[model samples]
Target: MVTTQRLPASLTPLDAALAAVLRDLAPVQPIELPPVDALRCIAAEMPALRAYPPHDVAVGDGWAMRANDLVGASSYAPLPLAGLPVWVEAGAAMPDGTDCVVDADAVDASGPLPQVLAEAVPGQGVRRAGSDIAAGRTVIAAGEPLLPRGLLLARAAGLDLVRVRRPRLRIVNISKGGLAVQLIADTARLAGAEVVRLKAGPDIVTIANSLDTGGCDLIITIGGTGVGHTDAAVNALARRGALIAHGIALQPGRTTAIGRIYTTPVIALPGAPDQAFAAWWAIALPVLDRLSGRRPRTTLALPLERKIASGVGIAEVVLLTRKQDHWAVLAIGDLSLDAIARAEALLIVPGGAEGFAAGTLVDAYMLRE
Candidate 1:
């Protein structure tokens, strides 16, 4: 079996360090998925074939008319028209040959006949076709996460379906915990990603066979990833391929391992439930987002009530709750599953001191609601 080398703790910030490591390593092999079903495809961006508001659609309930027809029309004395002007309700299509819309609010509609009280400008109240989005323009770029509004926009642009990069994933469960595996599988399912799991066994052939036969785009081996003699998951991965990173300068999940198996990424996590959650949130989640062509965004930091101390040289991820607009430490122990369970955010205090003073500014990332 090949032994693995431990990653050095550089003086860089955790985010920067993680980024540098990721930059040096290539992303895992990609998978193709249907646009309609590619909800969480990594790094996928589709262009708008047709512009938003593809045609001139009305923005309000009003009258559609040729600008010239209303040039001299006013409430003082109404100008007669050839009846080209028609009443169009809000969101109604502009009539053919009509170049403008006069909002009903702008004119007195209480009259038996709708009358215009003011002259309409050339482009007054007109929503020109392709104004919101031009044809053949890229509405969403690669590396942008699909938001709810964005999805709606894509559909509005006439994209019935889209091609998305699959959310390649690796789920490693260590120790004797069955709950961890179940949770990981459930999480992957919710994110629309495929997963692979492994139990604690010393058989290299079984491990290798799992890698060779699986449909996973990434690998996750849980439990045995720490300093224990049975913690050979990292070693096993290195023997199979090159090591990416073996240690992180972060607390609670500092022993996390990142490496490669062929072109697939293998991430090993600590067995503790809280540590596992931290590793997944701080590392795995961002990697998945980057690979799937989505923009990387962290949880927002809420206000803090007290000073918390972190390791002098280790980046700390603190579990906390935003109560009354203040971020209160949910639990001081990194291994506290209760803390994680109660947390709506994971606050990052970069590796440095043994702890944080109350009120120190720290970064925070919000969890999915």
Candidate 2:
């Protein structure tokens, strides 16, 4: 089996490494799932099967009658009805030839013939057909998340299932299992991926065997990416398939690696939480987005509260907190757990330029969606 004998002579540019990671990647195939099960999944185009409220229905519990029949009716001058009006509850289909609803008190059924004491204009208390949803109209657009509101529309349209694309992500932890893997898995799940987690020792053969891409669209190996004696993730990837880049020009995650095995792309992250997190946001998430066909994530553009100083030739991850309409710098380069936890958003400083000055408007991605 082929193996990378040593560390990369020089770190690969972050942009170049990302391009290699995303080369020829495509979104996963769509699947049919119950609307409840599709929550948080990226939706394929889902057209409404039928119009909601297939027929006009009452919006409140009242007497269903012809609006024209109640003309000039009032509590002081009650108008006698020709026949007893239908008593309908809220959400019930409006009686045939009826156009509106009147309150219970408005209809005096105690007498032989009900007397109308209120007037209701047409559709005043009715929900019109097709108002909530139209037949053959797209309820959930492609690449949109399937939220509870979407499910309500689906159910109203008589749809039992929805079509969605949820990419399968396999995360292999090559270090002693701990918080790093859990953090990555949680992040992947939050990004709408189906995650399968596994653990492998530091042995090259074990890691190589765990690189199987049977049901996964992407693979991420946590740890075993540095030059330490036990760092064998990159070498194992070379043995299994191809090691495209073994080192990247990103601070806190310089030891990260990018490669491919069979048809699936693989990313190797440093064991440290900070470095792994940096590489994940900078490199892995873009690949995941391609696999899931997710729409572009929202980014907030706000002025910086303070100046940020970053070194040249290495991309840096900056954590920030929103404080009184400005982004306050929490931490840069080496990030602590507290800083990461407290950060509401994150910004990546490109490798070519110095950091932004205080009060410069910067685009940052929210940590939580």
Candidate 3:
């Protein structure tokens, strides 16, 4: 039966809602993936299998010679070479019995007897063995995102694959999928989750069946989370699993719901783009981080260019853009499409606080790198 219900008498607190969503959830096990495939994934500690540059190599195009041989050698008192020094190209392994490299011009090769015109210091212009990487050393630490720079180091260490934790996310669009769903999917993917998109309607059975959590670490349902007659996401979740929070004390996304099917976490977002976006930052992001064992996201502390007035009862989402050195508020409480698109960062005002005054230093989470 389709059971219609009224709005929640009192909305659940934001922190309590988040705690219920994270209850009994643990980080998924790490998997082996190629460095290219592991981009943005939470990396597992990777120990170098072998030392890089196992042998001394030239760092530049020059002649390899013994630094001791060129001691006190200068243009005024050129040291004559018994034999022409070995020519080594950049990146080539230095020949045995050589400890330094000198530029071609430093060697007077035009003359029948080559003479050293400049002194060379030991280890100059040469990359020593294990200088880039040491054997058995930790090159990539655990709980950090595997970026391109980390991948470069992995490749240099001769690692074909890296270990990372990438959570599988299933997005269930409870209505005709549109831009709102697309935005959520893209955001989840960018957060290092493998996204799978599904579709359903407002019908209880259809929405309940689509809530299946098999093979996915998390599920996010878009649309039908409100208290209207057609809003059946909360009812469907209650029938299929445990509904943790049906209404949250958050602006723009008050109808958002949190639940769990079996062991997988599920977040039901409203259909509106602004509402879904606000919930994404305030709720979904924390769940993703916990599932992937990701480290704390970076936030910038900057002063607000102007005063922001907010209600004291509900947590409000604030969109901001960097202006000169301070953060300029683009929109408060309800964010518009234009504001969301133009926002460079986001700030959330606590439920207890009314708002911030001008020149108040506030921490904002970066939306873009």
Candidate 4:
């Protein structure tokens, strides 16, 4: 197995760790896919070929007629639906020369003809053409995520497919196939990436060096990142190329490592479930987002309900819960399944600060649970 190691101190600053590897990366080429499969993907360019609705349609079920025919009409004296008056249902295309809609609720349609008891004006209750969207107009920007609202817009614009940068990822794990592999695959796939999870057994060094990375934009090793003797991913990747950072200043994630093999970026994460989960979001996911042409995830502002301690040199990721109007830290012995399962939000403590006291206003990222 290949061997070379760039030893990092017990803890490395998170910002330094990220900068070393992200500087050389670029987004992958955009691919065309159906709108349903492109959720969360960054749009390359989206222009509508036709305007929404495509024609002037009625917004209500009423008589389609000229406003001049309804002049001086009131509850005391109603106008009859005579010449040129056309009966129109909601969403029906408005015929030529019609300019107003008189809802059935405001008129009596029994006995003779449909009539309006109230005066009507031009463009009243009538949706004009191109009001929603115009043909050939840019609907979405280049870097915006294709959220549900964006999908609706695309569908409305008569688009059945969208162009997006779908990243291809390789996830390396110690197991051949199981829940762990499934979880990692789901995480990467849900973020709009095509994933391939590889298993590296006892001879992780050999497997790591031989793992197929032909079309992969990024590789994430799910275990063998800690100080244990069996951990050899750091050395294996170093021999292949450059090891950016071996450790990050993060709680439950200090064992994380970021590097590059030839032209593909590789990241090493701890085996423990909680630590690996945190590291995925704190590190690996960000790399995937950039490679897939997406912007950073947004965070919210929330106040800490109680005091929480942390070392000055390393950043801490604390799980928080919603308590009435504010957020409170959910303390646990270590990051465990129970702890993560109960968390509703994540509180970040940067490396420069020592700790925080009660009522301290801090920025947080809400968990998707």
For 1-369, candidate 3 gives per-residue lDDT tens digits of 667944689999888899889887889999999888998888876655688888999999999999998999999999998899899999999999999999989989788898999999999999999898877766477888888887888888878888889999999998554889999999988888999999998898999999888899999999999877788988898889998888899998999999888888889999899999999999998999999988888899999999989898799999999999999999998899999999999999988898999999999999996
lDDT of 1 by residue, 1-369 (tens): 545334455533557546744564444444444446555444354544677675676777787777786677776787644333577876666788888888765455555665666788766777778887778876457665455655666666766666555655556455677665675666655554655555546444445444442566667666666665555666667667766677777677777777766656666777776676777777766666555555555557555788787657777777788778777888654547566667777776766566666665566776664
lDDT score for candidate 4 against the true structure: 0.76
Per-residue alpha-carbon lDDT of candidate 2 for residues 1-369, written as tens digits (9 for 90 to 100): 434446767889899999988989899999999887888888887654687789999999999999998899998999997878898999999989999988889888788887999888999889999887776677677988778887888877778888999999999998775788988999998887899999998999999999999998999999989877677898899889898998899987999999998779999998899998999999999899888788888799999999999888889999999999999999999999999899999999989979999999999998866
Q: Best candidate, lDDT-wise?
A: 3
True-structure lDDT of candidate 1? 0.64
Off by over 4 Å in 3: 48-50, 134-137
TM-score for predicted model 2 compared with the true structure: 0.95
Worst 10 residues of 3 by lDDT: 44-53
The better-scoring model by TM-score among 1 and 2 is 2
Write the number of the candidate with greater TM-score, choosing between 2 and 3: 2
Q: Give the candidate number with the greatest TM-score.
A: 2
User: Against the unseen true structure, what C-alpha lDDT does each candidate score?
Assistant: 0.64, 0.89, 0.90, 0.76
TM per prediction: 0.71, 0.95, 0.93, 0.86
Better of 1 and 3 by TM-score: 3
lDDT, candidate 4, residue 89?
Answer: 88
